[model samples]
Target chain A: MTLYSFIFYILAAVILLSTGWAITRRNLVHAVIYLVISFFGSAMLFYLMGAPLLAALEVIIYAGAIMILFLFIIMMLRVEGIEERLFPLKQWLPAMGLGFISFQVCIFLLISAGSEEPLKAAMAEPAIFGHFLFRQHWLSIEIVSMLLLIALIGVLHLGMEKKRKESGE
Target chain B: MIVPYSHVIFLAGILFLMGMFCTVTRRNLMMMVLGLEIMLNAAAIAFIGAALRHGHMDGHAMVIFIIAVAAAEVSIGLALIVCIYRKTGTIDAGCIEGDVCEL
Candidate 1:
């Protein structure tokens, strides 16, 4: 295998393993930390896949901002030590069985389906990507920004509501 | 040829399955949200792979919008989770579902 493909396999392993760990952790903080590692692995994979801009954005937006937000909220709520009954037999059995079946079916189809051709590595430069994004999806960008603004306002209102209730009580 | 396009799709499929498993089995609301993030990230990975395979920027652009939506969804979802925790004094999905949450 070429260096690029080797790196891709290694990164994929890191992502899958870390994510598995994250989901199984009982402590929320530990789970988020593991997930950050998983995100980092994916970011590297993004770079290897020739989307350097997305790789950087994955690091900044996902591993940095979003995970830190999760960590912040986890700490703020003080639920780190809360004990939870994870993986009840009823839930675990069905999910595991279904997931396993579906995963195998996907693999089978992938192997049997068309196009065994390899992907050609092509990098998307940030400048061209930005221009294309604006030119083609400017309206969508505006809508996303509006959605973010609404989310911010909703969060602020929720926090304020909780505070007001505390005062009123 | 670096690697077959199928390898990338396979990777994404595995990640998506993991996320789905997490979402289905996790009892905590926070973990559920985390699962959703994983699934979204998996989709982003698939999109990037498609972009690379097709040699186009559309998938890259879509990933950006995905990130934006994830940020928005997480913020709102977490806020709602916090609100539920405050009102119910518990973050367990079972408790919430039973409507037996006691503050």
Candidate 2:
């Protein structure tokens, strides 16, 4: 394997390992920290895959913004002392069985398709990517912006403290 | 050429399965949302890999949108989770009536 593939394998291993740790941690803060590492690994993978713009955005939005949001909520809730059944046999066994069966099916289909071609490395420069995105998907961008606005409004409404006095008035 | 496209697909599938497992087995509402984020990240990786394989920008575009949607989803989902915690005094999915939350 060449240097790029070697780096890819290492990064993939890091991501999988960190994500596995993330899910198993009982402390939500610990899970979020592990997930941040996983996201960093994924951002590097995006860079290796020649999506530099996505790499940066992944770091900025996912590892930085989203994770911080999760951290804030976890801190605000202070539910760390709430003991969780990490792996109740009833739920764990069924989930594992279903996951294993689905994964087997996925592998079977993948092998049946039998495409062994290697991926050719190509880069999408930020400039060209932006131009193409705006040119073809400006409407999509607009729709997403609207979606964000709606989400913002919904969050504000949900987080608003109800006026108990108003009910009596 | 770096690696076979199948390797990327395999990686994504494994990540997706792990995310599914997390979502299914974890009783915490936050963990479920975290699992969803993991699944979305796996899908983003797959899309980037496909973009590289097919020599197109479409997959990258999709990932951009995926990230945006994830941001929106997380904000709203967490807000709802906070509201639930406020009403029920616990974030545990199993403790619906607040009896189990002794603290």
**Which ten residues in a row are the worst by lDDT in model 1 chain A?**
A80-89
TM-score of 1: 0.93
RMSD in Å for model 2: 2.4
Name the DockQ score for candidate 2: 0.72
Identify the runs in model 1 with alpha carbons over 4 angstroms from their true place: A86-96, A113-115, B97-103
Clashing pairs in 2: none
Model 2 lDDT tens row, A1-169: 7888999999999999999999999999999999999999999999999999999999999999999999999989968766666665567677778878988977875686566766777889999999999999999999999999999999988877544434656
DockQ class, candidate 2: medium
- Cα lDDT over the full model 2: 0.91
Every prediction's TM-score for the first chain? 0.90, 0.88
What is residue A34's positional error in candidate 1, in angstroms?
Answer: 0.9
How high is each candidate's TM-score?
A: 0.93, 0.92
Once fitted onto the true fold, the runs of candidate 2 whose alpha carbons sit more than 4 angstroms away are A86-94, A109-115, A161-169, B97-103
